[model samples]
Target chain A: MIGEMILRNVFHRPVRTAISVIAVGVEVMLVILVVGLTSGLLHETAKRVEGVGADLMLQPPSASVFMAFSGAPMPIKIREKLEEMKYVRAVAPVLLQFNASGGLDIVYGIEQETFKAVSGGFVFHEGGELSAPNDILVDDWYAKAKQVKVGQTLRMLDNDFHVAGIVEHGKGARLFVPIQTLQELSGARDKASVFFIKLTRPEHTAAVADELRKVFPRYEIRPLKDFLSLMTSSNLPGLETFINSMIALAVSIGFLVIFLSMYTIIIERTREIGVLKSLGASKGFIVRALLSETAVICGIGIVLGIGMTFGMRAVLTRVFPTLTILVTVDWVLRATLIAVVGGLVGASYPAWLASRKDPIEALSYE
Target chain B: MQNAATILAPAIEGFLPGEWDVDLILKTDNLWKVYRSGKLEVSALRGVNFEVLPGEFVAVMGPSGCGKSSLLYVIGGLAQATRGHVLVDGNDMMALSDAARTKLRRHKVGFVFQRFNLLPTLDAYGNIAIAQHIHGNGFDPHRFEVVTSMLKLTDRLHHKPSELSGGEQQRVAIARAIINEPKILLADEPTGNLDTKNSEIVLGMLRQLNRDLGQTIVMITHNPEAAAYAGRVVHMRDGVIVDGVPED
Candidate 1:
């Protein structure tokens, strides 16, 4: 009977109920989208890096694993010394330049033969790779997103480069240029940003990585296979704080919305509460009714928020094809739990007030 | 003083000493309810003594500010007396805690209000059933139907209060009040918000419940015509009963 009364009361004020539900939904959606976008970007970037088929990455001392943040600081001559190591098949000394022309992208500068040996080589859809100083190979996703053609002239980094080919994506970057051109353009002549080392056998990865780590103890020598697992918000500086701040913002929105909604509803229903008390409703019963009403609203809001999140993911990916949004079950459940707890906590004070209201006074409330 | 209730308490002149250990269902001894505002104290019930036998239908009549409603509230356990005792069916209402008073209201006392205070969100049936549920017991479908049938509200059971006529809403309130079969039903101007025609219908239902179900009732009213329906009338002036003897 109390359940029925609660549901009926919730439905009694449609506009108020909808406003509360949508507020909570927006809160959940915000938290979910923030977490999803960050996790998706990190996971996608890590997967792309692993797709290079490198057994190890050798960077300059104290260089970050985030390729875009690392600069072309290592000497290109170090590739030969790395190539001299046991079980090392090839070492691709690549220059990385951050480009913000039409969009954000990492421009990879590579020597064709060694890069091909390290990555199994690009699977071309049209044209050919790295045949000229200004020939640029574009991946399919970037090609489609930017509408680049095989014979088109593409300008990046204030330099005009003819499109050499459009290849399959998932090779660490969307655009590739000759190593010497990027090194000269960036004024870091004969210096590579990082080294991608191919091994003769897959099992030799640990042994070679251990050997490299000991030789250059200060350098960031990382096995490519283990890189993705280490790429998380906790492993990245400031990322965890960014996510926590977003969650706090969402929780605050939920709390304030539920608080105002429940407070107003209780005041509006003061006489109704008095009627319930006159009917012998206990304080616990009134408290339970108010909190249950909040829980129901939050539950509906959570489902709506999850649906809205998926809809947004689709719209975002469609608008920006390069963008990836991964909606994980873990985060969805966490957001739902957070919204429920926030709503219940927000309603607690109003529930207590309702319970403590004098029945005669409440009955006489206008 | 003819009986122990009077002999044991000859202080109450109105009682004239009732018979024996008191077959009375309700008794208030020197009840006093004072409303204090800052440095002033205005008394609503001043040394009022009252008694009601089981199955009695009594109407309390008074002018405005005569403390009729306040007396009903105190006797119904909705409020506490300033300094006195209210015993309902041998249980001391003034001595019970807030929770115990609430429990008493749930199981022993039921109330009908002037405004027909049914929850607008619930239907007539829901309003009536909720009381039984609040009594912390299982629902009795037979009693529910019987109460509705007694009030001629069977057809209007599914209607919300807004959809029901004024008389129908009052009938629903009465059904809810007696749905749990409480020991006493306190009606505070139950028809004060109704039209003359609706008032007659609601008053008729109350009399029928009192006569047919033998339900003990204490009703507060100002209209002499409304009080005429009760078996006995107790008139009050300035918070004290001016006429205690039954003139019916």
Candidate 2:
């Protein structure tokens, strides 16, 4: 009966209830979207790094392990030294650059034969692999997004390059061109961004990385798996803090909205609370009623938030085909828990205030 | 009848140890209440002694601000007396903790307000059921139906308070007050907000419940006509009892 009263009370004032639900819903949506987007980015980065199929990555000591933002250049001489090592079978030097369009597109300059030897050969969706000096291979999603077809000329760094083929999704960077041509165009004659090293024996990866690290003390050399772990484990500067800040922002929004709404409700229902007290309602009863009402509202808002997340994800994917959004069950549960807890915390103060009101004074209140 | 163990066990075990005067179900010795605001003080009740026997219907009559309502509130354990003793069912209310007093109120006393005090969100049935819920006795469907039928609210149980007429709302309030079968029902101007016809209807229902069920009632009203339903009337003036005789 008390539960029914609580339900009715929530719906009794439709406008107030709607505002509270929408406010909580929007906060939950932001939590899921922001956290989900961050997770998607990490997942995609790891998959691409693994797809390179290299035993180790060697970069300048100051370069970031994150492939997309890695900018410090290493001497191309390092690739030759790595190939001369006993266990190293092949070494590919890559020049990485962020596109002018907000760094969403990654350009990789690679030697065709050495790249294919260090990493598995790409699977082309259309046309053949890299053959001409100005030929470039782009990922299928990026090709479609940028409308780059085979035989079409695409410009990068003030130079025109012919689209040679479209690689399968997640195969490589969004754009790939000849290393020498890119080096000349970018005015870096003997510099490469990073070196991908392949080992003859898979079990020798750790030993090879340790040896390379000692040989080039000014460079960073790590097994591919280790680098991926570092990226996902939040060891990258500002990533964990950024995600934590987003979560805090989302929870704050939910907390303030529920607090204000429930506070106003308690004020408006002062007489009703007095009546309940007069009818022998214990303080526990009043608190339970208020919290139950808040829980139901938060539950509804969470459901709406989850629905909105998937709907927004569908729309975003259609608009930006290359954008990946992973809505995992874990994230959904986390968002739901956050919203409910925020709501309960928000309503707690108001519930306590209502319970502590003097019955006679409240009853006489106009 | 409705599992006495569930309804009476807590009340019996937690009841305060005091002088057990079986005949006097409610008593107040020199009950005093003073209102304080900043540096000013106004006394609402002054050295008033009162008593109500079991199964008695007593009406307290007074003009506005005569402490009639304050006496009811103190006796009902809803307010504290400045320097006095209030005994309900032989337990000293002033000596009990707030939670214990709340429990005693739930198990022994019920209140009906002048405003009819029905939760607007709940229908008539829900409002009545909630009383039993708060009393910690759980719901007894048969007793609920019996009370609703006695109050002539059987057909109107599905309607919310807003949808009910003033008389019907007061009747529902009355049913809620007694749904737990409390030993005493404290009503403060229950018909103050009703029209003449509705006031008569509500007063009649109170009289019927008192007579048929042997329910102890203490009602506060200014109208002598409303007092006629009670077995005794106590008149008050300037926070003190002016007349102690019961009109036959």
Candidate 3:
């Protein structure tokens, strides 16, 4: 019966209820989408890195696990030394340059045979591998994104290169060129950013990484199998704080909306509160009824927000195919918890006011 | 007749030690209710002594602002008296905490207002059933059927207040007041908004509730015809009862 009254009161003022619900929905959507975008990109990027068929990645001294952020400080001869290591089967030296022409992307400069040895070669969709000094290989997603064709000239890093081939995605980077060609183009003549080492067997990755770490303790030696686990917002600098700030902002939106809605309800229903008190309702009962009403509103908002999240995800991913927005179960639960708690807290003061209203005065309230 | 336990429990728990008065259902001693705004003092009730015996239906009649409503509120524990003692079912309302007073109101007192005071959002059944719910008493189907049937509202239980006539809304309010079996029913002009016929019908029901069920009642009103429904009338003038409760 109390539940029925709550529902009635919720719908009694439709416009206010809708505005509050939409506000809460927007808060939940914001929290979910903000957390989803960053985590999805990081996880997807890590998966693509692990998909490169390398068992171990060796970077320059004090280099970041994110090889894109690390410069080409290591000499290209480090690949030869890594190739001669115990249990090392193949090594590919890659020079990376950050490209910002159309969008943010890492350009990989690689030697054809050694890159093929480490990555099991690309599945070309249009043309073959890089052969000329100005030739470049683009992946299917990147080709579709930038509208690149097989024989068209693509200008990047202030250098025009022939579009040699279009390969399947999920290799390390979208755009691939010869290492020595990119080395000259970027003014780092004998430099490579990182080495991708393919071990002789799967189980020898830990031992090989440990041995390499001892030889060069300052260098970053990361096993590819553990890359996905390390790709979290907390592992990256300032990213977790950014996500928390967004969540706090979302919570504030939910709080203020719920506060105003419940306060308005209290004022609008002042006479009704008197009736409730005259009916012998305790303060706890009144508080519970108001809070329960807020919970129902928040519940509807959360469902709508989650639906909007998936709807927006579909629209966004379709329009931007290369962009990945993942809505995980963990983030969805966290958003729900956050919205509900925020809404309850926002309604507390109003509930207290309602419970404390003088019965005679409230009955006499116009 | 009330159940044996209902009759016996109040005897045991409804009084401070050695202060029990079994003959009186409600009583007030020098009830003074003063409403002060800054330095301007307005006395709503001043040294007014009133009493109601068990199973008595008493009416408090006065013009507007004469403190009849203030007396009702004071006795029902709905407001604190500036200086007075209100005893309901042998329990002093002045000394109890807010929670205790609320509990007393829940179990021992019920109220009906001039405007019906029915929650507009709820239907007749919900309005009636809510009283038991608020009193923390479990639903009693037999009592519900009996009361709704007595009011001739068994079929109209699903109608909202807007759908019901003025008399029907008042009947629903009356049903809500009695469903919890409160020790006393306090009403402030239960028929003020009704037409002549509806007022007659509602007053008839209140008399029926008092005569047939032996329910104690204290009704506040200005109309002499409305006060005539009660077995006795107590007239108030200028915050004091000019003519007190009549001899049974």
Candidate 4:
């Protein structure tokens, strides 16, 4: 009976109820989108790094393990010394550059023969692989987003290059060019950003890393697994804070909207509360009723939020193909839990106030 | 003074003593209620002793500001007396905690207000069933049928309060107050908002319920016609009982 009463009361003022529901839905949507995008970026980064098919990685002493932001370039001669060591099957040097389009595109420069030797060769979706110094290979997603086709001219870093081919999704950088040409364009000739070293046997990974560490004492030599772990860890500055702030903002918006809505409801129903008390309703009963109403609203909001998330993902994938959004069950559950908790917390004060009203005064209220 | 047969039978009384026998279901001894706002004190009830025996239909009559409503609220355990003793169903209200007092009200007392305070969102049946729900027992279909039939609300059960007439609404309120089978029914001007015809209808229903079910009732009203339905009427003036004097 109490539950039915609460449900009816929630619909007593339809406009106000709709507004509150929408507020919660919008907040839940924002939380899922922001968190989902971040997770997708991390997942894609890990996959791309693992696709290199290397057992060990070598970087300059001062360079960060995160390839996207690492700026310190190593001497290209380091690849020859690593290839000569025991248990080293092959070595490929890679030059990394941020494109002139506001750093949205990562440009990787690779020597065709050594890159194919150390890592598996790329699978082209449109045309043949890179053959000329000015030829570039783009990923499918980037190609769709940039609207560039094979045999078309593309511009990056204020230089024109011919589009040679389109790589399979999640294979490599969005834009790829010849190593010597990129080195000249970046003004760091014979300097590579990192080296990918393939081991002869799977068991030699740790020993090979130890050997390379001694060979280049001042450099950072790590097994591929440790390097990937470092890339995914919280070593990225401001990322943790950014995610935390997004969560906080989402919670605050949900909490305040529910608080204001429930508070206004209490004020409007002061007389009704008195009537309930007169009918022998305990304070606990009133609080439970109010909370149950809020939970119902939040439940609806969460469902709507999840629906909107899938809808937005579908639309985003079609419009901006390069953007990835990962909506896993765990993330959905987390968003629901946060929204419900925020709504309950917001309603607590109003429930308390309604429960504490004097029955006589409330009865007499106009 | 009239004997029990004259008073408890169908005879009318202008005044009665404030004391009763040990069979009392409700009693208040020297109950005092003081309202303070910024150092100004207003005493609503001043040393008022009252009692109602089991199955008695008693009426408390007073002018405005004579503490009739305050005394009813205190006896119903809805408000705390400033300094006094209130006993309902043989339990001392002052000795009980706030929560216990609430429990006492939930299980032992039912209230009907002058305004017919039915929940606007609920229909007549829902309003009546809520009292039983609050008492922790799901609705008793048998008792619901009995109460609705007795109050003549069988046909109007599904109508909301706004859709019902004033008298029908009050009947629903009466049905709600009695559905839980509380030990006592405390009504504050149950017919205060009705016309003469509806007032007579409601008063007749109250009288029939008392006579048929042996229900104990304490009603506060200013209209003598409303008080006439009770077996005895106690009149108050200036926060003190003026018409009723108990025999030692």
Kindly report which residue stretches of model 3 are placed more than 4 angstroms away from their true locations once superposed. Answer: B1-18, B246-248
**Tens digit per residue, CA lDDT, model 1, B1-248:** 23325323232311223223456678888999999899999999998888888898999999999999999989887788998888776667777778877877888788999999999999998999999999878789999889989899989889999999989999999999999999999999988999999999899988999999999999999998899889899999898888864432
Which residue pairs clash within candidate 1? B6-B17
lDDT by residue for model 1 over A1-366, one digit each (tens)?
878998998899999999899989998998999999999999988998899999999988878778768754888888878888999999998899998899889999999999899999999999987889999999999988889999999988999999999999999898999999998888999999889999999899999989998877888999999989877988778999999999999999999999999999999999989988888788998999999999999998998899899999999988888888879999999999999999999999999999999888999999
Taking every candidate in turn, the Cα RMSD to the unseen true structure, in Å, is 4.2, 4.0, 3.0, 4.9
- All models: lDDT? 0.89, 0.86, 0.89, 0.85
- Kindly list the per-residue Cα lDDT of model 3 for residues B1-248, writing each as its tens digit: 23112233254354343264457788788999999899999999998888888898999999999998899898888998899788888778888888878888889998989999889899999999888888786788999998998888998999999999999999999999999888999999998899999999999999999999999999998889999999999899999999965444
A-chain TM-score of every model: 0.97, 0.93, 0.96, 0.94
Given the true complex, what DockQ would model 1 score? 0.70
Fraction of the reference Cα-Cα interface contacts (below 8 Å) that each candidate reproduces: 0.73, 0.87, 0.79, 0.77
User: Higher-TM-score candidate among 1 and 4?
Assistant: 1
Rank order (by lDDT, best first)? 3, 1, 2, 4
Q: Candidate 2 residues A1-366, lDDT tens each?
A: 888899999999999998889878887888888877877877777678777888888888877777657665878987778888989999999988766843367788999999899888888899888888899998988877777799898877778889999898764577899998888877778889888888999899988878887899878787887755676627567878988898899899899999999999999999999998888788998999999999999998998889989999999888787787878898899999999999999999999999999999888878
Stronger candidate by lDDT (2 vs 3): 3
Q: Tens digit of lDDT per residue, candidate 3, span A133-238?
A: 9999999988987789999998889999999999999999889999988899889988989889998998999999999989888898999999899888887789
Docking class of 2: medium
Any runs in candidate 1 off by more than 4 Å, and if so which?
Answer: B1-22, B38-40, B245-248
Write the residue-wise lDDT of candidate 4 on A1-366 in tens digits.
Answer: 888898999899999888888878877888888888876777676667677778888888866766758776988997879889998898989999988673377788998888888778888899988888899999888888888899999888788899999988664477789999999999989999989888898699988878877888888777776645565426677877887799889889999999999999999999999988887788999999999999988988888888988999899889888888888898788889999999999999999999999988999989
Q: Give the CA lDDT, 0 to 100, for residue B65 in model 2.
A: 94
Error of 4 at A86 (Å): 2.2
lDDT by residue (B113-203, candidate 4, tens digit) is 8999999999998999999999888989999999999999999999999999999999999999999898899999999999999999998
